[model samples]
Each structure stands twice: as structure tokens, then as C-alpha cells.
Target: MFDWPLLRGPVPSVVVILGAVSCIYLLAARGRRGWWSRTVPIVVMIGVIVSVIADKVIDHVLYSASVPVEVLAWIGFGAGAIALGVARAWRATWWQRGVVVVTVLVVVAMAANSVNRYYGEFPTFRAALGLPAAGEVAFKSVSAVVEQPQLPVSGRALDQDWTPTVRPPAKGVVTQVYIPGKVSRFTVTRRAYIYLPPAYSDPRRPLLPVLVLLHGIPGSPSDWLTAGGLAATMDRFAAAHRGLAPVVVMPDATGSLLGDPMCMDSRLGNSASYLAVDVPMWIRRHLQVDDDSRRWAIAGLSYGGTCAWQLALRRPATYPTFIDLSGEVEPSLATRAQTIRVAFNGNAAAYTRATPLHMLAAAPHPSVAGIIGLGRADTTFGPQQRLVYAACRHAGIDVRLLVLPGAHTWQVWSVGLRRSLPWLAYRLGITAP
Candidate 1:
């Protein structure tokens, strides 16, 4: 039951149905008194109003990123709030109070299920509990397997003669490690996750390419491993090519869980420096991987996707190749003026110069290549992505845009990453170009 899938199958449907039934009972169970009936309606109305106002505040004022939470989630929230009110206020029989308690639980579950369905972030109950999935271990324990090899003079791809001397692990291993913000001095402490492909288990420890995966706002590094299916995808890719896949590193771009650094160097945080400099330096020193900038690729979904664009543009030599999934054209916070005020500390000139369009128009990038993926139903970011695609072309970037199904959800992102793997593998030199 712990690993039971939460997003799909009959589980969510059953929960929704239960919530509906509970709501109906709560609505019909008002006492025979006229005042009780009037009071029940009043409380329910208040609950609905409160939920709507809160949603507006979160979506319109607090966050610039359009959250994927649907109206169904707000309905559930209202119902749960009403149930709690009834349980506390109604002077009723013990059975009625017990029913209200059950209703509260069911409605809360419904709201969570509805929200989770939108993002598809937590697919299983185990993941919802924030537990590491199977085959995950602490980083310190896996250090023995990582061997330091002689740094190459020129960039090198996987050698044709390289073969596993020992039986490689069937799947890659995921490890959680704290990458210190030594240079950037990023204060918020968060651990980065590493994915060592099956090839890394070999005694020779073939130095593989690295792919840095970034997560969206209101998320953590674990988002990629859990909803993004990092390990399983890499394992399948490696199995097809004699245990060869890039070592994927998922780092914390934002200092806090909900903090929006906008992937820039300013008052919010030195997220740009952390990602561009600190992360690369950490990868080189701690992990036995290729140092060639050409072999490194960066990818992200939404906020992370926007950051990927910024990194590739700001430091082309470091991340020449990138995959952006449903990212905004530019970093934002409610409004352009507010974004500049918060992220750049009222430095509108710096903010304007930092946007993707501004950076692309200012300079040409002939060596950079990128893949832009957007959902067919995503009317919001789809146009933004199209604009970015045009700008990239004008700036001499080798870029492709893919319109997949689903809107600003993990459905698009997971598939986008999977579809881009063949091209990514070829570009990263995991497979022959």
C-alpha cells in the first residue's frame, strides 16, 4: 500500500467519489431547526469564498509562475474547511460528529489528490511521504565506487574499445549529496542528488559525460528522481548501449523550497553563480567525470527550464546544449516592474539586459544548441516558447521546438525528457553522433 500509485488507476477516482458522498451527507445533515439550516448554508458559503480568495492571492500576488493546481482542488479545499467547521460548531449526536470527522479527512485527501494529479509530482504514497525510492543511498557510502582518473588533455567521448570487465549493475544508483555553495556563498543549505549509470559500477570507472537537471519552483532536487523518473530512464538508455549513459546531477537552483531566485545573481540569491560556477566546480572535484564543456548539458522544467536557458546563454562554453521544458521566455514575479524590483533590487537596466531576448539580440551564439518542449494545451507558455524559438534562430542557435500533449504538467516534462534522450545522447557523445 505504501508504493500504491496515487495519481492514476482507481485510487484517485475512489477518493473523489468518497469526498462527494461525504459532502452530500454533510449538506443534508443539518438539524431540523431553521436556524441550524440557515447556519449550515452560511458556513458553507463562507468556506467557498475564503478558498477562492486564497487561491487568487497565491496565483496572482504571491507567485509569478502559473501554478498547475486546478479548480477541483479549490472545491475540495472548501469542502474540507466546511466539514471542519461543522464538526466543531454543530451540537449534534456522536454519530453525526464522527461522520463529520470522516468527511474532513476524505475532503482533505480529495484536495491533495486533485493537486497531485495536476503536477504528477507524487505518483506513489511512498513518494508523497518524502522517502527515497528504491536503490537510493547516502553520498558518502558511494564514494568508494567513484575512482579519480587522469584528467584528459582534449575532450574525449566514450571509447569504442571500452567494455565492462565485471558484470555491471542492472540499474544506476541514486545518491543524495550536499554540494557546498563555497564560491557563490548561497546560504540556504540543500543537498544535490546524483545518478551514476550502470557503467560507473565497472572497475575501470569509465569517465562519463554529465547532465545537470534542475527542478521547478516549489520543488526540490528529488523532484527529478521521483516524478521525472531519472534512474529508470537512464538505466534503459544505458542497457541499450553497453552500460553507457551520462552521469546526471540534479542540483538545488533555488535556496528555499518556494524561493524564486530567478536564476540570477542579485538580492534573492546568487543562484546564477551557484548553478554556473559552484555546481560545475563541485562536479569536477567530487565526481570522476568528463571536464569537457562540450560534453556537459543542462535541462529543466518550468522555472528550472528558464534557468537552463539563462545558463546556456550566460555561459555558452559551460552548457552549450540545453533542453527547456515549458519554460517562460524570461524570469518574472507577477509583473516586470516587480520582478526587476525584487530580483535586481530596482535595477531595471540590469533586469532588462538579463532577459533571454535581450541577451540573444546582444550577442550571437553559433556553438549553442537547444531543444524547447511545450504542451499543446499550454496556451500560456506555448507562445512564450515560440517567441524564444524565434529569438534563438535570429541569434544563430541550433534549436528545435516540440509541441507535446498536456498543459504545464509533469506529463509533458517526463515525456519531453524521454523523447529528447536520443538527441541528447548523440549530442553529449554517449552515442555516436
Candidate 2:
């Protein structure tokens, strides 16, 4: 049951077919007082209104991101179907009501499964239930496993001095650790997940490079672990390179699952400071990795992508390389005015100082290099990404823009991560460029 695929295969299709048949049966079944004739139209109208309101609420007040029209259609269809079921059951027999209830449930499942397939958020039953992936362990256990003498490597690439051997383990290990906001003093308690490559266990322990991953808003560090397929992706790369992969660190940028820090030191949260200062500091102190700032890179999807772009431009010395997957034009909350009012206390000047476009245009960042990834069908963010790419190019920043297939969903993000791994590896000194 845990392995039941939610996104693809015959399950979703069969559920959809059942839901369609149920809808037809519910509408066609004879009833008193011309119920189907009067109620169906009213329910459809109400569903349309509700869907419009929901789309507006999500875009304007909640996430500030647009929901695809297809998903909105499903929302309306579900609403109408459920209302029809209830209305019909009002004058039906006991068994008929029972059948209505089952029909309603199937309709709900169909809508839910359709939405899930659209976003690819929960690809399996296990993920939908919020369980950790296989081979994940507590942080305390990792400490004992990595208690080795300090054996630091040079500032050069790992491929420069290291050779692959059959001695190293075939797979890496993932651990969940609580990374306190020590320097930023940002009081948000969230555990981080770390992926140590197989080469990390070498007796002659070479200090590997680090890659800090950030997840989108409405997400936790585990999004990268599950939806983004971080560990599996990194493990595959490691296998190809003879167990040589950067130490991937996934720390919480947003304090909570629904929190949007905007990756700034604002009244809402000291998210920028926590990510740029405390996260890197913690990585160096706790993990046996290279201390060279140039050896580090930052990458993320959506909100995390925007944050990565912000940090890389703001602190080029710390993160000279970055990957932005389906990021917005800038880090914002609904609108520029609202973001300024909420985050900067309505200080437009202060907001300007924090905006990435302003910073990029202010000076030439010749040292900063990054990749801007966009989904081919992402109508909303595709334009935003092109605008950002132009800004980066004009500012003399070494940047590459990639347009992959899919919309603003996990499909695009996961593919973006996998596609960018080779370039990331080269940039972080894991392999040759």
C-alpha cells in the first residue's frame, strides 16, 4: 500500500473512470420534485463561484502563486459533484443515500488524485502519509559514524587528488538533525536533513565540497528529500563518479511548513541571516567538509530558488554558484507594496536595497555564476525567469538559462535538479567542467 503510485499508472485512471461513471449514474437516477433539473444547475453555478474565489484567495492572500486552471477546474467539478450527491440523497431511500455517500467519496478521491498528479507532490502512499524515506536515521547516530580525525583536502577539486576504489560503500547515508539558529537568533525549531556521500566514509576522509539545498514555501526540508528526490538523485550521481559527490545539506529556510520568510531579515523572520550565516557556519563546524567558500553552492525550487538567487548575489563570496528552479522575478509576498509594508515597515528604500534586481543592476558581479531553470509551460514564471536572466546577463554575471519540460510542479523541479547536477558538480569542484 505504501508503494502505491499516486501520480502515474492504472490507479489514478481507474479512479477517474469510476468517478465519471458515478457522476453519470447520480444525475440519471430518477428522483421526485425535478431535483436533478433544478439542483444541478445551481450546484454548477455555486461551484464556479467557489472555484473563482479559491483561485483568488490562493493567488492574492495565501501563497501569492497562481494555481493552474486545470487544478481549478477539478476543484469546481469536485464541489459540484459532492453538492449533487447530497442534494439527490435528501429524498432517496437509505441504500440510495448510502450509494450517494460512496459516490461522493469517489468523486472527492478523483479530484484529489487529479490535483496530486498535477503537482506530483505525493508520488506514493508513503509520501502522502508523511513518512520519512528509507535509510533515514537520527542525527546522533551520524556523529559516531563520522567521528574521524580532521583530514582536510586542499582548495582544489576533489577529482584532482582522489581516485575511485571498490573500497567505499555503494550508497550514502541521510540523517535528520536539529540545526539551531545560533547566529541569526531566529527562534524557529525545525530539523534539517543531511546527505553524506559514500566517499565521506573513506578512512583518509577527504573534505568534500558542500551544496546547500533550499525548499519552496509551503514546504519543509523534507520536500527535497521526498518530492525533489534529493538523496536518490545524489546517490546516482555519486555512483557514476565513483562515490564522489558533494555533501548535500537541506536546512529549513522557512520556519514552518506554511511560513514564507521571503529569505530576508525582516520583521517576519531573520531567514536570510539564518540561511547565509547560521547554515554555512553549522555545516563547517559539525560536518567534515571543505571550508573554502568557493567550494560551496546553493540551489532551490520556487521560493527556495528565489532565496538562492538573493543569497548568491548578496553574498557572492560565500556562494559563488547558484541554481534557481522556477523562481519568481524577485522575493515577494503577494505584491511589492505588501511585501514592503509587511517586511520593511513600508520603507521603500530599504525594500529597494533588498531587491535582487536593484542589487544586480547596482554593480557588476563578475565572480557570481548561476543557472536559471524554468518550466516550458510555466506561463507565470517563465516570463519572470526570462526577466531575471536578462538582468543577470546585463549585470555581467555569468549565468545560464534552461527551459525544461513541464509546468510549475515537482516534475519540473525534480528534472531541473537532476539536469543541473553535472554542472553543479563541476562548479563545486567535484568533477571537471
Candidate 3:
């Protein structure tokens, strides 16, 4: 069943306004006769209440099911319900007629506002709805880029339909594995996609090292498969460098509000356990992977980059190579004393304990290797890379910082991954042909 509660912010507003207006018009037409008028309003209100409750229950149930099927089923249910409701209220009284007209006008106005949101051209009506100003601005900025139109050009279709030719993985297999986390009771279960290298089928070869890939805030494992194009790049690299390719595991890391957990054990949930414990366990149990720390690496973009450092620092025994692609490290004690104290319940020491910088104060793990990449134009993350580089240098850890050309977007990360893969493969004892 569709979980209406899972619908985005605008969807609920649309449903509530339309549903309430429909109920009001129905009552007005029925003339409030006998207890019918009073009873109908109460019943309609009750129905609304019941629908919300049912939505939550359904959401919980669906989340536990297979992820792909659950998404499709929920969408289908939501569409059917909306259609039924609209059809039932199509014919109505004078007040109902007036409501229909007003609703149409309101929808028109909202559509205009959506256009503005798409262009980043105007302030959204969300402020009128009482959303925070900063949230509104962020929402507008993100939405504008997402909603922008792409030119109708494809690799193979210049004169035909404007369909982009998406190249499939040459010899990789993409499989979704669900690992139940403690937070799954309240939120979506953690999802991980394992991408096997081209040589995975070869029986005589040693198992390839695994690179745990993480996505940024508001993104899922599918982001790498769809946007990052890691599989295609890895395929090409493998073909060039013998038959060896590193297995990549993309896991959802946004178990907390900060999106990327920085791979720390969060007080809000067991996100760190989900990533560090559950994910590795799942990989080892299900796939043919190298068991040694020297064969395991971790890399991520943006928030994932932050997580890469945290995971490596916290559990150096598990991951040997850490790749930070334009990622910022949590501020050091001297730099973030006040901010840490405020953010972590006035516990500066606790903050330091949880931070990657603090963990690196001890001698670097001999098994662990670190690579930091940043774009020159990415002023925000460049300095962060430098900080991590400096700390690793001071600790006498084997770390390399590469300043590439680009900004904070996927373009930089994609290029960084291509460059970093060869080094990672070499360290992991995988020979490129």
C-alpha cells in the first residue's frame, strides 16, 4: 500500500487543502440535515486522521519489504487514491463549484511559484507556509539545479529522439543487499550495492580488494551507479590494467540528519555500527573478497569523503587505504573547541574523541594508507584536505594529498576516482594488464 505520509512536503499540503475543501463543500451541499451535517464533518475529519495513521503504518511495513518493489507499490497506491478522491468530488454544489474554481486558481499560482523555484528566480511560497529562511534558500538552490533543463543531445542520437546512450558496466554485476539496522524501525533500512569487478569470475585469480563507496547528503547508493559512472570507469581501467579491477561497495550513509555520519557512532542512531560493522560483515559473508586489511580501501565524495577518513581512523584494522575526494575533516580541538562543546552537549573532550583528527593523534596504523584529493577551485574543501594532510604528515602516516583542477561537484570526484583507482589497485596487489 502507498504510504501517503512519505510523500514530500508539497504533496501533503496539496492533499490536505484539497481533501478539506472537498469535505466542506460536501457538507454545505447536504444542508446539515439531521445529525448528517455534523456527523459528516466529524467522519471526514476522522477519515483524514485514520489516513495519516494508516500511512505511517504502511510506510513501516513497506520499508521492510524489498526496496524496489516497495517503492513501486507505494507510488501505485498513492496515484490510485488521489485519482479516486478527485473523481468522487468532480460533481458538486455551488459552494463546491466555487471551491473548484478557487482550487484551480491556487494550483495555477503554485505552478507559477514552481517555475520560479526551478529558475532560482524568486522566493518560494514556503516562507508563507512558515519554513525557515535558510531552509527555503537551500531548497530553492538545490531545486533550481535539479529542475534545470539539459540540452537535447545524446551520444548516438543527434537527429533522432533525444535519448542519452548510457553505457552498461562491461563485466560488473550490480546487486542490492539490505542490512537491517537498529534505525530501520524508524527510518529506511540501510541499502548497499556491491559492484563486482570484471575478473570476479576468474577462479585462479586472488580475490580483489574492496573499496567501500559512500554517497553525499540527500543521496542514495544509486547515485554512484547513475551519476558517478564508477562502473564504466572501473571497467575501462580494468581492461587497460590486465584483468584486475577493485570491487566497489556503495552503501547509504545518511542514517542521521547530517546525511553523511562522518562514519562516527552517532548518539541519534547506530549509523556507525550499520556502516562499520554490518556492511563489512555483509560483504565478507556474501561475496568472495580479500580478508586482509591491506586489500581493503575506502573512498567517498564530499560527505562520503569525510566518512572515509572517519572510518579509516576509527577502525584502521578494517580499511588499509582511505581516499578523501574533496572532503573536509572535522575541526581539530584547538580550532573547534567552542563549536564542539556547543554541538556535542558542552563536551569538548567527547567531541575530540569522536573526531578523526583526535584519533590520528596516536601512531598511524601501519596497514592503513591515505590519499587526499581536492580541486583548486573548491575553496571550501581544499583547506580541509590540507588540514588532514598536515595532521597525517605530523603523525608520520603514509598519506598523499593531490590538488586536482575542478570544483566541488561530481566532475571532480569522477576524475579523482579514475586517478586514485590505479594507486589503490597497486597497493592492494592487483596487477593491471
Candidate 4:
């Protein structure tokens, strides 16, 4: 769950809160002329307090559980105000009645915004409306494919190459897989999906590179397929290259669909092990892939995007290239203290040690490759990403930053992926330099 400051920043939250308070004060002062009017602001003040407390509790619970029960608390506030309103409406003066209604509405609106955390499985306001629904995105299971070979093998050849038995149409095939975490043992409960390019179907194509992708919190791996438009984007790239594109594998970073593990091996779940260890092991065991660090990349958006940096920075031997789309500067459970309490057993020093920014700052010029992209209007995360990008650049890491349109919405993330493909292809060794 997000605080008012997280959604709209500190200044906006302060202004709105003050505005509500001022309106209530004036509403109460006007009641000095009327007997029943005196009780109007009193009831309203009580209702607003109830709403505020309810807001905090609901946000904390929903952040852990990801349920839609916060609406119930909002409904309770509304009903309480209505009941008090009806009890006084008969004897209250006209102005008093009007003030009560307006006060209740303001309280209710503020309460709703305060507990505004869940946006279903899609992106925020603008992107949710513009992007395709989750069900509209499609994927099929892997079937017969012809193994092939090509120029410039990625590493020492051992396993046979892979390709689809038949040529893929415009849109490539996405296969659903339930990769068990036999090694990492980090709760292999959630099933994941993979995208094979058109070239995978060719019997004469070279062994292709791989991209291990992930999605945001309160979301499944399907978000990339449905809203991010990655499959279609890669398919288009493949069509132009005679069916040659990187194999895209989207794994479940969060153990439960709505749960956030901060992509770390914490009490929430062994999520870091799940992604950095189990996911790659499963991919190599199940599919024909380029296991080299240069050929394998990991990336995500928002929560998953931050996790991408964690995996790349912590486990650089496996994944050296990464893409972070609108990710937080570091792992966030809202505030620094709360994040420390939850993720690091209240040990602030331990958290600082694991922080991506700190790790990047302390590194002795690691040869890490990254692409950071976010919306220009996303005040909350835009500035943070810029700071991280600068840190990475100064630390001698090869990193690029992109400022796109769409404020913290899927518009920026989707376009970021589309624009970064050529760069990703080159880094992953899918395209010729």
C-alpha cells in the first residue's frame, strides 16, 4: 500500500490534508450561529479521525496480503456519516445540513485516496485504460521443434540447438511452464510463461540468446505478455530478421501472485534464490539456451524492476546485463525504517549493505551493463532513477538512461521495452555488432 506522499508526493499530500482540515474548521465555526450546527463539525471530526486510522491499518494489511477489503472500511465511514446525518437532518438548519454533506464527502474522498494501493493486476490510471486486458494476451505451450546451428556459437558447444518444427507466423509462440524449484526450494508454487521467437521454429537457425523477465508486485508473469506487449514486440523484431529473436523467459519473482518478497531471501519467501538460482537452473534444464552471462539478461518493471538490479548486481556471474523500467532506487517497504524492520530484521546496517545503490557505489568498477528507463513526469521514481543512473555511470559501469512519456504508467514501460530491444539484442549477442 502507498501513502499519500508516495502517490502524489509530500507537498500535495500536505496541501490536501490542510485543505480538508481548513474546510472542517470553517464548517465547524459557521455552526456557532446554529445550535445543531455546532454538532456537525464534531461528528465530522470524529468521522475523519476514524477514516485516517482506518486508512493506515488497511494500507499496512493490503501491502502484505494484497486484498480489496479496504473498500469495506471506506464504506463503513460513509455509512457512519449518513447515520449521524439522518439523526440531525430534521432539526438542522439549511446551512448546517449542507455543511454536513460536504464535510462527509471530503472526509470520504481523503480516506479513499489514503488507502489507494490496489490497482488490480494492471498498470496505473492511464496505462490501465489504454492497454489491453489481461485475457486478451495469448500464449501457447511448446511443441515439436527442429534443432539447428548457426555461425558464432555463444559458448563451448555441448547441448543440441533448438528451433520450431514449422515456421512461426507473425506473432511468436509463448509456452506455459511449471518449473519446480527442486534445487532452490523457494516455493515453486506459481507457474511461469516463456516466449520463443519465430527463429526457434526454424530447423536451420542458430542457438539464440535468452532474456529472463519478471513482472511487478500484485501481478503475475502474464503482465509482460498482456500489458507490456513484449511478445508482439519481439515477434515483430523476429519477422524482420527472418525469424531470429532472443528467447524470452518470464519467471515468477514473487512466490504468490499478490505477495511481495522484495525479491530477497527473507521471511516473505526465498524470492532471491527463486529468481537468481531456481529460475535460471530451470530454464537451462527445460530449454536450449545460451547459459553465458553475456547472453542471459534479467529485467522487470516497478517491484520486479528493482529486483532486476538486485539479481544483476548480487549475482553478476550469472546475469551481467539488465533492464530496469520504473524501478525503485532500492528495495522499498515504503520508508527506510519500515524497510529495515521488515527486510533486515530491524538492522539498518544490514540493509545498507544490501542496498543496490550502496553496492554500486562500493564496487571497484564492475563491468555491468544496464538500461534504465522511466517517464519524465513520474516525479516519484523519475528523479531516483536518474540518481542511480549517474551513480552507475560514475562507478564505471556501462549504463544508459531513457526519459520517456507517460507518467509512471505502462505507456513508459511498454515503450521502454520496444525502444530498448535493439540495444538488448546487441548486448545479449542476438544481433551482430
Give the alpha-carbon lDDT of every model. 0.82, 0.86, 0.59, 0.69
lDDT of 3 by residue, 1-433 (tens): 1212212366546745764554454334343344354544454555455445555544343221111233333333333333333433455566765655565444334333333232122222332242322211221121112122223232221113222133222555556666555432323345566676645544333355788998765457756665566667877876665445777888777763334333555444456667677778767766666676667888888778888888887778887678988777773212355445444657767777888877888556666687898987776678878998998788777889888876665667777888887677667656422
TM-score of each: 0.92, 0.95, 0.58, 0.69
TM-score computed on alpha carbons, candidate 3? 0.58
Write one digit per residue (lDDT tens) for candidate 2, span 297-318. Answer: 9999999999999999998989
Tens digits of per-residue lDDT for model 1, 304-328: 9999988999999999999999899
lDDT of 3: 0.59
Clash pairs, model 2 backbone: none
lDDT agreement of model 2 with the native:
0.86
Note each model's CA RMSD in angstroms: 2.6, 1.9, 16.2, 9.1
lDDT of 4 by residue, 1-433 (tens): 2111224456337645854673454344333345355566565666666656665764575442122345556545554556455544556789977866766666555545544422222323333343333223244335444354454454332122333456656666776778776666777566687888767656655567888888886677767876676777888888766677888888877777667778777666678887888778877766766656667888888787789878888888878989998888888675779878987788888878888888887775475799998888777678878987887888788899988976666678778888998888878766665
In TM-score terms, candidate 4 sits at: 0.69
Candidate order by decreasing TM-score: 2, 1, 4, 3
Off by over 4 Å in 3: 1-169, 182-190, 203-205, 256-260, 331-343
By lDDT, the best candidate is 2
Candidate 1: list runs displaced more than 4 Å: 34-44, 67-69, 72-77, 80-89, 145-159
In angstroms, the error of model 1 at 116 is: 1.2
Quick one: ranking by lDDT, best first? 2, 1, 4, 3
